[model samples]
Target: MYLSSVSRPASADPPTPGRPGRRFALVSGNVVALGTVSLITDVSAEMVAAVLPLYLVLGLQLSPVAFGVLDGVHAGATALLRVVGGFVADRFRRRKLVAGVGYALSAVAKLGLLLAGRSVPVIGAVIAVDRLGKGVRTAPRDALITLSTPPESLGRAFGVHRAMDSFGAFLGPLAALAVLLAVGQSYDAVFVTSFCIAALAVVILVLFVRERPEGGPPDTPDGPKVSVREALGLLRDRPARRLVLAAALLGLATIGDGFVYLLLQRREDLGLRWFPLLAVGTSLAYLVLAAPLGVLADRVGRLPVVIGGYLALGATYLLLSGPVHGWPVLALTLALYGGFYAATDGVLIALAGPVLPARVRTTGIALVQSGQAMAYLVSSVLFGLAWQLWGPENAVRAAAVAVAVVLLGTVPLLASPSRLVTRKVPR
Candidate 1:
């Protein structure tokens, strides 16, 4: 498939001077293959995500605090495993294999959800298993993209991948809605269909995605083994440390998509059936903006783009809490939320890709991702508490303030030009 078609070597090739299209033109076939895998996987994942909030809050009658805990667990359940997955992939030079395992685990977890029924603990456990699969797969998958693409075009590469991924996200909720409508609100059918689609994604990964693209990062059989100490040593680098800290801070400022959508649904008094469409709105905006913003990040510098994303996030939170009513608020909030994701998600990883050593690249990415996930867990819980204590409006407003504070704090951490420079970690 795509693996055989790309004849060009994958070594970092600086964009030709004055070539306007060089940035995206440099994105490799391997990146596209990986993106396809992510696209399929997201379709499977987002199907569950689209309906989960309503299932837990409305069907199960969970309080905000209980829902918060489950949501936090959903995000952070595999934080430690991400590092393990990354280290294993790096050590064995089997990124594709590790990623496949994670994918399979998540595909099976879909069935677990079917078995869990209405039991909260069981549902939480299933969610954790699903998230664990995500945690395991994410870093290695992103590392593969970085390894496949040139440093100069990393932004475009990740952007292209995320855009494809968002396209699937855009489709997923619609698919779920269709399933629900067809089967008379049968979540089981959605789960089964999701598993089938997820299984297909795994098959695609095994067949189409190359373990190592031609001229990609060195992972020769004779190369020195990647060690735990070496993985930990990534933090010793100033730029890498700052990047991870910045990522965690950014995560801390953010709340879950479920919360945002739920808040909107409450404020707008949207019907239960229309809930899934809210995610579709966000994903549609994400699909449209992801690639353009990525290209912009490469051109203007990633930090500014990332900062702007957080600004969009703050605006989204404000809109949720603000007095603005009717469809305009919903449209603007969803757009800004989607823009926030488009601006930050892949771009931050692309920014970090150039800073870490090739051998520990997956581990480095995992560390960054793990930190962010852990913080996201805390953020979700805190936001939940805020909602319970201060009510939704005050809670969302506080979240907006938090975003502003974190953005200000992040600027100084990332302000040093040297903080983003590529560095070699000694053996």
Candidate 2:
């Protein structure tokens, strides 16, 4: 229903006095506060994520098929709820409250796992609950960031936020490992510690984060009050609609990260002992590059950066099927994979920030995210089936091809209609 005022970088309003060159200062305090919340929450969440598979498959001796189904549920069960959460937040104008509820739900779910004992169904439910919290909080939390920062610096703001988030992800497994060693590998100890950490995150959110008022004075109207219908109607806008579809299409071409690591192990015939290190390498790369990439996206252009990230992903797929051997392949592929994440993860949302109205921002973002998540679910299944039917090499090459085609198609869909979309593509 609305368009960003500028189609190119030069037309953008100059940064407010004392703002443009000041990266951290230009970023809103809300972003840093949320980033801290994410860092702590991710550590708690990741601590469990790092150990849950081992506890389920090895300790409980569940079949691979059962684990696969549970894994898919864990990853995808929250997709639709994301829209619900976003809509609720916008409708009530209570984003912080909605996000807080999500955080509390996740914190409590950590304790639920401890009570679930060895029961498979109970454990599955607990995991689902935890994921639901993640889904619910994500859109509102990101919406807060967009509301807090200037539109021009959205990329850099998201970058710093993601960097902090990635840092937590990097620390999570390590924290789990330390807890395990400290408590003789007791899963209950890890769960309790995770709950404590998550609870602390909730406390930080309540104490530090401030919510925008429901409506301002007569002289200053906050955009129209958002309704569920208006939120959904965001799709009526051409640019927004294209962004949603393009995100889903791009996501369809992406198989999950685990598959990439597994392929690397299979290709190199790497030892079981080194399997975990593959993830570590990728995380290292992501942590190192996320912030810089964000700044680059802000400076260069978000669309090009996003496309470049996907290109990095396609290249990673190609390298997996390439003739390269030994450590070089491992290092290069992992770096490219990390680059892919750095480029697209937050950048995509940052790209979407200006396209949709502030009134329905959370809902619009949730729509884009839900599409990607659903497509990712289908993509993972399709890739697995392809691997079985055509073998890993063929399956991977097909993925690379799909990524190339999607990238080409997406460029035009995302292009601004006014002109050649120079330094900053239109919102």
Candidate 3:
């Protein structure tokens, strides 16, 4: 099978193969360290994310429009920063340091929530700060994973990392609930505890993660430092550009998970108490399937696996339209939803990794991610409007149609090496 363009430094050895005596010997040590950090950090971030909407909407009593604006900000405000963080990390060859800075910024923002209290503007600002840190850290962290692992095992490595990340997501809300129960429903205590956990994640990053060695071939003059212009020029490559476009297109069709669960709840007349459990179900599926699906992608191919994921998503939207109902539909939809994330989330980045030059891998990944985030913000707004005008069922049906169109287009765009490849230049 033809391989994608995986540009690793000549000096850096390929990732080690699985060993009989060593557990997880197939995966690199860096991936494990990063995954551990992500697991702890996600526990902290998800704790706040699970409750921030309630704190803003019910606690502060913001209007729907105002809350929607905050949500949009939470989703898309980091678009530019993602590019900046990626570019800076690539330029300085300090992926771990940049990632750590982002992690630190997020850890500190947990405390900012305490100071914000019930003030709407303050809360919005704090949320934006937290998202900004996520924006900054994500690309650099993903890039580190790509650079540190072998191309052949990229899917498995990312799968393992995302599974760990999803495991944290599954636990975060439970952790918050436990804190609330213990502390007599004190949000402040939750915030404080979250900050402490996040700080520990930062410590893990500092002590364990190592930056990959930089510099290309010995003969290459370390290719001029990656500048902003070069970073922007990343899309000039055909496959890279197509990948970005496809990601955005798919993202535009996808609505937020909250909306999906709300529809199911309304259809089933589910109790308010059980609403949060919907997310837990999906996270559980994701945690279970991420690693296995990733390994499947490595053994088979990433493109087909990614397409299968969106197909699962389309099925989810269709399921919401009520051809099927009750617990069976809910269970199937949640499983598909989880499968969608397992297939696409890390796999998309892994697909992008080999197609990009190592020098600007972070920037390229950030570009793809930012495009999708911006599209998702737009999609959320559009879906909300569609729901208001045409009702939830029709809106979801339309979304299913959109996903179908994009998924079909993406299949060919990323089908083979020749299509994605344009020209390889000395970096």
lDDT (C-alpha) at residue 273 in model 3: 44
Candidate 3: TM-score?
0.87
For candidate 3, the per-residue lDDT at 41 reads 95
Any runs in candidate 2 off by more than 4 Å, and if so which?
1-26, 53-68, 116-121, 213-224, 265-276, 323-325, 388-394, 416-427
Best by TM-score: 1
Where's the lowest-lDDT run of ten residues in candidate 1? 1-10
Order of candidate numbers by lDDT, starting with the best = 1, 3, 2
Residue lDDT tens for model 2, 32-117: 89999999998898788767766776689875446645665676668899989999988877889999999999999999999999
| TM-score to native of every candidate shown | 0.93, 0.85, 0.87
Is candidate 1 or 3 superior in TM-score? 1
CA lDDT scores, all candidates in order = 0.85, 0.78, 0.78
The predicted structure with the larger TM-score, 1 or 2, is 1
lDDT of 3 by residue, 203-261 (tens): 99999987862221111226678887878887787767877887788777788765777
In model 3, the Cα lDDT at residue 114 comes to: 96
- Go through the candidates in order and give the C-alpha RMSD of each one to the true structure: 5.8, 4.5, 4.6
